[model samples]
Target: MKIPFYRPYIGDEEIAEVISAIQSNWLSKGPKTVVFESEFAKSVGSEHGVGLNSCTAGLHLAQLALGIGPGDEVITTPYTFVATANTIIHCGAKPVFVDIDPKTCNIDADLIEQAITPRTKAIIPVHYGGYPCEMDRIQEIAQRYGLAIIEDAAHAVYTKYKDQPIGSIGNITCFSFYATKNLTTGEGGMITTADEELANRIRILSLHGMSRNAWTRYAAKGAWYYEVEQAGFKYNMTDIQAALGIIQLRKLEEMQMLRMQVARAYSEALADCEEIILPHDSHEHRHSWHLYPIRLEEDQLTISRNEMIDQLSEAGIGTSVHFIPVPKHPFYQEKGYRMEEYPETEKVFESVLSLPFFPGMTKEEVYYVADTVQSIISKHRR
Candidate 1:
């Protein structure tokens, strides 16, 4: 069978729970969402987890909760999704983009200090491709600069950096449950934090600053009066989405095992292919393997990277690119950034291809993708 780029693994349990939610008539943020939050926090070793509408909301809320605004700068990688930068902009702050480390496609922790200015308030390090970033280095820089750290953990559901889970150590961390991410709530997000004050503020900010939820105010024997203590956004996650998340989170470990196995297979099969540079592991860090991207050696291969993607599709294999440099986007261009500032990001953009990876893929399919890619490269090798 042709392999898909990515697909969510929804079992009958998901269907049953979704129906239960629909029938319960409490389709808004209610018991299920709260339960999902509790379970997720426990699994990821977080003190608290607040469910939201999207990872963008999580990052934006993190900024609001931390009092980051005008005249503040958040340092981040230019190699992540535009949302990472856009969230900082939403807070009326600027995002100072740093170049990514060429090997791991993560923000270069060593270079972050140079970007820190008096105006720099925080650093939002992304766990790219589920690979744990050098958090020790990142946190040390943050501490030295007196800056907060909010992790963009959208791709790192199960990742650990130096034995610490991504959400456990960051000042605040944001995650995505988009269809393409490891865990899908169709469209949802989470904010995990150890700080009690930050967690309380984020919970309020996500629910339109309402002192109490509608379920608390309007449900049986509930009070109707409440106060809006904070001006906030409507970032709450609906029970429907959370219902899916509850089931998805339960299956995460099983899903991750399959993903890692596929990654290992790819690494072993492509070890001798000089035209491709395989993904790397961080020292003493566990990768979540959210993405499997191979960098093509264009000169050694007769076909361009773009052409390889085309050929993969023709051969019944779907592929994608993790990202283009954030600064190269038109919006960022308007803000006066050139590709020359990020050498590694610019070079990697041309060579990278995100192969199909998901829990639903079978071992036979994995081999098929591996063999097909090698065959295609063998035909094109100069």
Candidate 2:
């Protein structure tokens, strides 16, 4: 009866792959990592992929590859994980926050124009909760403004916009392979881009800016001497993580189907509840269904969002909130980001709740979660 918010879908295949990686005795960035990068690029409709230790690392490197640094500004939505904005700061650039669309909870493309300034160098739009942002419009803005598009697609592994994969649309797209993500390598990420030059730069930067990686320099046919190209951070993915990534990538479709099924079950079960506002989906885009977030109509319910979460926990059903709006965080607040400037994000944050969702959840478990949520709402209704 105890249902956790997330559990990685690892199977015998993943175990075997890890074992094979162990047998190779090459745990650092090796053959498996290279193959994972290639296969992942193909899966996302991108020409190249650079594996990294975390999505944050990929985002930081993306900004660096685009020459974004001191005195520059990057526009992004406030209704996302802080990493979206933190990455901009990591590059010694300022993060310009924009409001979100209430419906999709993604960055509102209409509001982007006003945020642009002379110092603007990039626009990092997050595909929030695996829902595709208004990419076409965002692209038009980026093109007209001469800004780079670095998509924060951590929650959007298989999402698509206008029949094009998410990874292929942005100038550079970052994906997460965290334990809770749709596809996982426990703690890893990948950056994809169609530009080969950018890919090469990212590769070099991901592994400490060395001219050659350990795998290459130590190989039989490889040279022992290599130059230090640039001062880059240590953010390389290991062979063990890549092995897990390969198996997870192969099972992605199968896992996605189950995720969709759970999403539908939640939607159908909660459709009749007036106190609940379900997440949006459209025919024009493919959502990865990574997180099934629901909003409470506070007017109809006496309990606050926090109380509702507590009630769910009491019912043995775990839950989470997607985000708290970046501006509301102490770091951003101290940096002069005002919550009032992002009204939509602030409003959404107060009511949004992510239910227990994952590929491993059976139909019965899905319904039980729905029932628990309904019971909590009914008891709290005014």
Candidate 3:
């Protein structure tokens, strides 16, 4: 009866891949990492991929590669994780926050142009909970203004925006392979782009800004000497992570199917419930269902969102919130970001609750969660 929030569907294949990586004795950014980068890029229909230690690293590198620095402004949503904004700060740029579209919980594309200034350099659109932003509108705006698009696709590995994969649309797209993600490599990330020069720059920046071929310098055929092109952080992915990523990438479709099944079950079970608003989905944009965040209609329920979370915990059903909004955080507040500016984000934050959703959740568990939620709502009805 104890259902945890998320349990990664790691199998024997992942373990075997790790073992193989360990046996190969080439652990640091070697052939396996290279292969994983290529395969992941191909899977998402991107021309190039650069593997890194984390999605944050990929985001940071994306900004650096685009020459976004001091005095520059990067427009993004206040509804996303702080990493999306933090990367902009790391590049010595200011993150201009835009409000979210309450329906999709993504940046309101209509509001983006108003936030743009002469200093505006790029747009970082986060596909919140795997539901893609309105890319067509965003793209049109970017093209008109000559602004770069960097997609924060941490929750959108398998997501598609109108038949075009998330990775292939933006100038640069970053994906996360954290433990809780649908496709996990324990802790890893990749950046996908169509520009070969950008890809090479990202690869070089990921590892101390060494020569593009420096990763292979220690190999049997590689030379011992290399030169540093720029001062970059050590953000390279290891062969071990890439080995696991290879198998995980291969199993992505299988895992995504299971996630979709669980999402459908939740929607079907709660379709009649007026006290909650289910996550958004559509035919044109394929949702990856990374986090099944449901919003409580607090006006109809006596219990608050936090109280409901406590109740779920008491019932042994683990739950979480997808995000707390970047502007609401203390760090961002100190930097002059105010919550009052993001009314939509604050409204969504007050009622949103992420349910226990994972690829391998059983029917019994799904029903138990549904029944528990219903029972709680019935007892707390106004």
Which candidate achieves the best lDDT against the true structure?
3
lDDT of each: 0.90, 0.92, 0.94
Location of the lowest summed lDDT over 10 successive residues in candidate 2 = 211-220
List ranges where model 1 is wrong by over 4 Å. none
Model 1 lDDT per residue over 1-382, tens place: 2789987789999999999999998788888998999999988898898999999999999998999999889999999989999989999999898999999999998899999899999999999999988889988888987999999999999999878888898899999999988898999999998887898889888887988454467567778887888887899998999999999999999999888888888888788889999887856898988999999988899999899999999989999998988889999999998889999999999899998988778778888888888999999999
Q: Report the C-alpha displacement of residue 251, candidate 3, in angstroms.
A: 0.6
Clashing pairs in 3: none
* Pairs of residues at least 3 apart in sequence or in different chains that clash in candidate 2: none
lDDT per residue, candidate 3, 1-382, as tens digits? Answer: 3999998898999999999999999888889999999999999999999999999999999999999999999999998888999999999999999999999999999999999999999999999999999999999999999999999999999999989998999999999999998788889999999999999999999999999879888899999999999998899999999999999999999999999999999999999999999999999889999999999999999999999999999999999997989988899999888999999999999999999999999988999999999999999999
C-alpha root-mean-square deviation, candidate 1? 1.3
Score every model by TM-score: 0.97, 0.98, 0.99
Candidate topping TM-score: 3
Better lDDT candidate (2, 3): 3
Estimate the TM-score for candidate 2.
0.98
At residue 280, candidate 3 shows an lDDT of 94
lDDT of 2 by residue, 179-267 (tens): 99999999999999999999989888887788755448867787888777999889999999999999999999999999999999999
Q: Residue 320 CA error for candidate 1 (Å)?
A: 0.6
Ranking by TM-score: 3, 2, 1
In candidate 1, how many Å is residue 250 off?
1.3
Per-prediction tally of clashes = 0, 0, 0
